[model samples]
Target: MTKIADLRSQTVDQLSDELLKLKKEQFNLRFQAATGQMEKTHRVSEVRKDIARISTLLREKRAAS
Candidate 1:
């Protein structure tokens, strides 16, 4: 999970990269769940929240500029 402060310190490009990675992780988690091979089920929610946070931050940055 990423801290908001840490994310806030990063540039937009960096945040975009992080968001992409998290999205990929979320996809893998979903796949794992579907296959009944998921161990840490809580990670799905964490990754989702992280994605939301990054998206919100990105929107705020764009709107501010």
Candidate 2:
């Protein structure tokens, strides 16, 4: 899990990369849940929150530019 402060220190490109990675993980988590193979269910929510955080930060950067 990534902290907002840690995310804030990253560049836009890095954030985008992280977002993409999280999205991929999110997709996998969904698949696992559907198959009843998910071990840590909390990961789904954590990934969702991280995705939101990264997107929010990206938007803030865009708006500030």
Candidate 3:
């Protein structure tokens, strides 16, 4: 999980890259859940919230600029 302060310190490009990685992770988690091979079901929600947090931060940055 990424902290908001850590995210706030990143440049837009860095945040974008992190967002893409998180999205890929989310997809893999969903796939794992579908295959019944997932052990950490809680990670799904954590990834989701992280995605939202990054997205929100991105929006704020854009708006501020």
Candidate 4:
């Protein structure tokens, strides 16, 4: 799992890309859960948090820029 502080150290575009990837992963996780094939249920929450973290970092970077 990526931390907010770590994400804060990254560039805006990098953060955006990471956020998109995380959202995709989250979608996959949900799909897996729906099919009763999720091996890690906690991952759903983790991915959600990562998405929030990336968004926060992106917002901060934008504000700073």
* lDDT for each residue of candidate 3 in 3-64, tens digit (9 for 90 to 100): 99999999999999999999999999999999999999999999999999999999999999
Which candidate, 1 or 2, has the higher lDDT? 2
**Can you give the TM-score per candidate against the true fold?**
0.97, 0.96, 0.97, 0.91
Model 1 lDDT tens row, 1-65: 88999999998999999999999999999999999999999999999999999999999998998
lDDT of each: 0.95, 0.97, 0.95, 0.85
RMSD of 4: 1.0
RMSD per candidate (Å) reads 0.5, 0.6, 0.5, 1.0
> Which has the greatest lDDT?
2
Worst lDDT 10-window in candidate 3: 1-10
Candidate 4 ranges beyond 4 A from true positions: none
Q: Where is model 1 poorest over a 10-residue stretch in terms of lDDT? A: 1-10
User: Of the candidates numbered 2 and 3, which has the greater TM-score value?
Assistant: 3
What would the per-residue lDDT of candidate 4 be over residues 31-64, giving only the tens digit for each residue? 9999999999999998988888888778877898
Candidate 2 lDDT over residue span 1-65, tens digit each: 89999999999999999999999999999999999999999999999999999999999998898
> Over all chains combined, what TM-score does candidate 3 have?
0.97
Q: What's the lDDT for candidate 4? A: 0.85
Residue 25 alpha-carbon offset, candidate 4, angstroms? 0.1
Greater-TM-score candidate between 3 and 4: 3
Candidate 2 runs further than 4 Å off: none
